[model samples]
Target: MDIFERKPVNHAIHTSPSNDLRLVESAIPDIQPHECLIHVRATGICGSDVHFWKHGHIGDMVVTGDNGLGHESAGVVLKVGADVTKFKPGDRVALECGIPCSKPTCYFCRTGQYNACPDVVFFSTPPHHGTLRRYHAHPEAWLHHLPDNLSFEEGSLLEPLTVALAGIDRSGLRLADPIVICGAGPIGLVTLLAANAAGAEPIVITDLDEGRLAKAKELVPRVRPVKAALGEDAKGFAGRIVSELGQEAKLVMECTGVEASIHAGIYSARFGGSVFVIGVGKDMLTFPFMHLSSREIDLRFQYRYHDIYPKSISVAAAGLVDLKPLVSHRFQLEDGIKAFETASNPASKAIKVQIVDE
Candidate 1:
């Protein structure tokens, strides 16, 4: 071995049944010929992480044991297997959680859309562990080398930024497309950033929480923020958005999985426009099929992401968008339990809570 892998135990945070999370030590993972070991520097707590911690599963992936729970992460290279040439020890890199099977026979992989590969093993998604630990091992190809200008915190945020970029790309947004985003949370905020970068103008964002709406306006001053009133009908909500923007939106990005928000996005869109859904909602949603079909609205969906890390990193490096303000809270690895608690509850007003190595 070229590098001395001396650590015998790695302390990691895991989620168990009954909303339990604890810090425990386990043996450091071994690196394969094409893999590299990373000493985790920072990991961001995601909404999915909170869902898994509270319910022990997000749909079908249950936390049977002390399952790790994080995917948005960045760290330094600790060791690299013999065949790893892209990175070496002390290199800084951001981790991409999903490892898709790149076999040529797989249709998705054959078309360079590996994010849709059914055989992908994404971190923190059942049976597979995540990067919210002292050390992690990943295939070299999935990691993106971070520039010296990007801090570990900024690097951790690239995951969600890539998601936003992927959503915008999938939506096929055109220049100056009037867009409405249905939520002002992390995903929605990042989507706004992506839209603005893509030349989408006069964007409108909605959320029930006034604070989030305010934060959205603060982050992107040009974005028109609207607060969703309680029990507001889709038509009424859409009317408010249209009235605010002075015209019906050409693109509606549904970042909230709430069925009502989805409906609002549909109705807010202009005739023959598109509604891109980025949030993962229920398996089955009862939508206004007749209305959407009659209006000829294009309903699109964006999965996690595909081949966007490089572009996302490049954009972030170039200051095309400022993501640093999105990180609202921070906790050490040992205080991960508190991190989860804060993320689960909205009292902390946390847009993105990051966990740093102690």
Candidate 2:
């Protein structure tokens, strides 16, 4: 062990079914041989984290036990396994939120569909702990090294960026394809960038938050933002799209996961266009499938990524996408609870909140 090895410490946050939250310090997790210990440098609190805090259980999988939840993360390599060769101490890296089963024959595992692996362990979800700690340990292969130019905060976002990449990749987006992205949250903006990178000619975004909508416009000026209000009817959504862009979009990537937004994306997509569902909302949504079918809309689901980290890093490094602008709030490792609460608040106008380990 390194003479300066920091002792692992525990920290936790609890979320009630109705959205109440509490912060506490607990015990540290152990590092296994195939794993590496990472002193988390920065982690972004995802919408799912807020959902768990607010709704307790999303669908059938409820977080019945105590666990650290922040998953969109970046950290420094504190210790590497004896046989590890890809990385070493001091390497800045990002952690993929999901952990797949090691068993190769598990259908999804054998097909590189690890995200669907039945035995996968993920942070803050039930029995599995998370990286929101003084130290976190995970298998070495799951870690992705970050470039020198990317800040820890930006590095922590590889997960979201990769999600955007996967969405665009699956959409079969090509040069000059126009896109309409619903919801201008971090994922929405990231998906816009992914679409922009994939040669999608015109990228339009829709959101209820004007500030977030503006940020999306500022970052990617070509990305037109359609501001709307939260309402039961689709009038706000439909009016904004028609007035702003003047035509139906060929691609609609739904990042909001809200029932209304999902319906809007389904309606907005032109005939034979695609809709990539990148956000997580109610598991069961009431839908008008006949209309979507008539439009020949191809609905795609965005799960956690497979092997897009290296490309995400490269895209950030190449300046094809610079995510630093999205991170508007930050906190130290000791103040994770406060960070998550801030992240959960829509009024905070928060884009991204990072937990700094240092």
- For every candidate, C-alpha RMSD to the true structure in Å: 2.1, 2.3
What is the overall TM-score of model 2 with all chains considered together?
Answer: 0.93
Provide the TM-score for each candidate, comma-separated: 0.96, 0.93
Residue-level lDDT tens digits of model 1 in 83-126 = 99999899999999999999989999999889889899999987
Residue 262's lDDT in candidate 1: 94
Please give the lDDT score for candidate 1: 0.89
Model 2 over residues 1-358: C-alpha lDDT tens digits? 6423554455555554445666666655567778887877788888888777777776776867664577888888878887678889989888886888869679998897788898988776765666666677878988888888998888888778988887777778889887888999989988877777778767789998889889888888887888767664674576667556667778888998888998888777788887788889887888768977887988878877777888899999898988888888988767777787788787788898887866
Q: Which regions of candidate 2 deviate over 4 angstroms?
A: 1-8, 12-20
Positional deviation of 12 in candidate 1, in angstroms?
1.4
